[model samples]
Target: MTGLLAFTVLVALVGLERVAELVVSVRNAAWSKARGGIESGQGHFPFMVVLHTGLLVGALVEAWVRRPDVAPVLAWSMLALVLASQALRWWCIASLGRRWNTRVIVVPGLPPVVSGPYRLVRHPNYVAVVVEGVALPLVHAAWTTALVFTVLNAGLLAVRIRAEDAALETLPRSTEVEHA
Candidate 1:
């Protein structure tokens, strides 16, 4: 019963996060549209959302029913990783500023963002996303969450990377042209 309540709370938290993201996405879409931003890969957006929702549900179900026994040390470690992932995700957002969004939008003539986290990896946001997907559930010893989300997210990332790469392919060649 306690586990079920905890899992329910977690689900609520995840739902809140999704709501926040949806709000952000709406604002981002409006901002980009106002600036005549080009949007590609609209097709994959639904799948991404569904998969993330599934990840949270899967974690909750596994933890509540399976009641996985997680050691304190491992739980703490996973918690730390979750925190670190959030930090990295925010870092990516802050670094990208206006360019950072859930959608793949490219503005013509504007150079790709190449500062901060982008300097290290072309897709730091995705890195944070991947880490969080696995770490969050595993914090409760739900390895099921880690495995399911990692595999699901991997497939999503494959589609995302290809779409983003293709979207950015049309940029005018220059000295600062960065490749992922």
Candidate 2:
């Protein structure tokens, strides 16, 4: 019905968004590697991939099967959150620019980014991920997917952030650079 169509469109959009992220990640990863980037947290990366893929698949399956009544308030609110999440995600990406990759590969001499959302948060991208994982599902009343993805993503982020921090610890911090 109409709900299914809406859910399908949402999932399609999310899938497209992920494809774009991968495109950017691949390019940036190569850029970083060319500049002597060393990758950490490689072990958990596959799981992270699977988990994210599951977020989309699970959301679609649950929303279709459960057919939960969409409370306009919850749906609209969560929709807004989903939109905000994408904005925050792109902000993190734009902030990092050539330095942003999905993987935690750090270039030794390069400065830690202190621009955009980085000024406020150590891992603003992860914040976007967490919010999107929860809010995207809730947009169509897929509470099960939201809860599961949130918990799993939390564990993943803990490992990811730790590995990233460990890697960063070996490098010297540079003063923030002003961008136009």
lDDT per model vs. reference: 0.78, 0.90
lDDT of 1 at 72: 71
Candidate 1: tens digits of C-alpha lDDT, residues 58-132 = 888788888877777876787778778778877877676666678998777667777777788989889888888
Clashing pairs for model 1 are none
User: Can you give the TM-score per candidate against the true fold?
Assistant: 0.87, 0.96
Which numbered prediction scores highest in lDDT against the true structure? Answer: 2
Q: Which residue runs of candidate 1 sit more than 4 Å off their true CA positions?
A: 1-11, 173-180
* Cα lDDT of model 2 by residue, 91-175, tens digit: 9999988888889988877878888999999889889999999999998899999999999999999999999999888777866
